[model samples]
Target: MNVVEVKGTELEDAFQIRREVFVEEQGVPLQDEFDGYDESGAAARHILVYYEDQPAATGRLRWLGDTAKLERICVRAAMRKFGLGSVVVKSLEKIAQEEGFCKAKIHAQTQAQNFYERLGYRQTSEEFMEDGISHIVMERTI
Candidate 1:
């Protein structure tokens, strides 16, 4: 698998991956999934992973002040359990740090808390519901 930084036309693939996982699979209302952040977020960085020349996973980083929030992380269902998700996160974290972010945070789904923990992210709050799904805030200092 290979990870690549994407922008402009290349970002369509990453957006589609998020739409498939968050909107279509998880039912996270389409309107809420795609928002105003796309056009003006100078800190936004998208990372896409490909396997055998096919897009297999994707994620994005949105910087807020000194912190970079990693969001919409997802691997194509058929590509799960293959470490593609980890690759996507690690690559994003590297990019975040290189960009001078002091920390990285993510709102991890409750079911995936352990996964994030294994990746060095620690839960910073009790579980909460967002758009009907349980989630918790996790963070890792860069």
Candidate 2:
């Protein structure tokens, strides 16, 4: 498995992975799963994790002013055992740090809070619902 920065057509693979996991599987609406950020000129940085040349996971980070917001993280269900989610987070964080971002945050689904906690993220907000799913805001210093 390998994780790397993606652009242009390569981002289609990222979107597909996200759609499979978030929209089709998790029931998130298409309108919520996709936004204008995927457009050619968006400031978001997308990352794709491929195993055997097939996209297995994906994520993105974008500047919300000085903070890097990590979003859209998803790993193929079949590839979850490989710890690809952590790999994707670390990769995104590296990119954020390289870009001079000292802080990173994510609206983490409640079920995945422990995963982010293990990676040094701390919950910063009360649990809330986003798109009908329980979530909480988390942050970490990269």
Candidate 3:
């Protein structure tokens, strides 16, 4: 798997991946899935993972003060269990640190809490519903 940071026109493919996983696959409302953040946020970093020349996974990073939030992480359904999710998180962490953020945060879907835990994220709050799915805030200090 290869992780690359891309923006502008290069982000189209990543947006498509997010639509597939967050909108189509998960039934999340399309309006909630793609937001204004994609256009106005200067600190937004988009990561795309390619396997054998095909896009395999996608994620986004948004710098908020001293912290960075990893959001909209998704792996193609057929690529689940192949470690692409972990790879995406690790890549985001590296990018955050490189950009001077000392901490990283994510609103992880409840079902994937254990996955984030294994990646060093600690649950920081009670589970809450977001986009009709249960999620919890998790954070990791780099």
Candidate 4:
């Protein structure tokens, strides 16, 4: 398995995975999925996880002051059992550290809160709704 950093048109695979997981599978609106920061050149880094050369997961990281905001993490439904989700998050944290970020944070869906916790993220806020799904903020020092 390998996680790759992408930019410009190279982001298509990452976007495709996100659309598959967050939009079609989870019912998150398409508009809410691609939130425009990618086009803004905000220095956000996008990553794609490939398993046996097949794109199976994706995520992105953007600097938020002193912390790195981790978002859009998703593993293809068929690929979830292979531990690609952890691969994506670990890869993102590596990128964050490479970019001088010492902390990482996320707005994780309630159902996946435990998964994030296992990855060392601690809940930082009460449950909240985003795109009609319950979520909570989590953070960890990377």
Candidate of highest lDDT: 2
The 10-residue segment with the lowest total lDDT in model 3: 35-44
Index of the highest-TM-score prediction: 2
**lDDT of candidate 4 at residue 72, scale 0 to 100:** 92
Which residue pairs show collisions in model 4?
none
TM-score: model 1 vs. ground truth: 0.93
lDDT of 2: 0.93
> Please, what are the lDDT tens digits per residue for candidate 3 over residues 10-77?
88888889989999988999889988778744658889999778898999998888889999999999
Residue 72, candidate 1: C-alpha displacement in angstroms: 0.8
Would you list the C-alpha lDDT of every candidate in the order shown? 0.87, 0.93, 0.90, 0.91
Instruction: Give the lDDT ranking, best first.
Output: 2, 4, 3, 1
- lDDT tens digits by residue: candidate 2, 1-142: 8788998887888999999999999999999988888877798999999987789999999999889999999999999998999999999999999999999999999999999999999999999999889999999999
Q: Which residue ranges in model 4 land beyond 4 Å of their true spot?
A: none
**What TM-score would candidate 3 get against the native?**
0.95
Q: For residue 16, give model 4's deviation from the true position in Å.
A: 0.9
In model 3, what is the error at residue 36, expressed in angstroms?
1.5
- Residue-level lDDT tens digits of model 1 in 1-142: 7889887788888888888898999999988887665543455778899998999899888977778999889999989979998898899899988887879999999999999999999999999999889999999987
The C-alpha stretches of model 1 lying farther than 4 A from their native spots are 40-42
Error of 2 at 102 (Å): 0.9
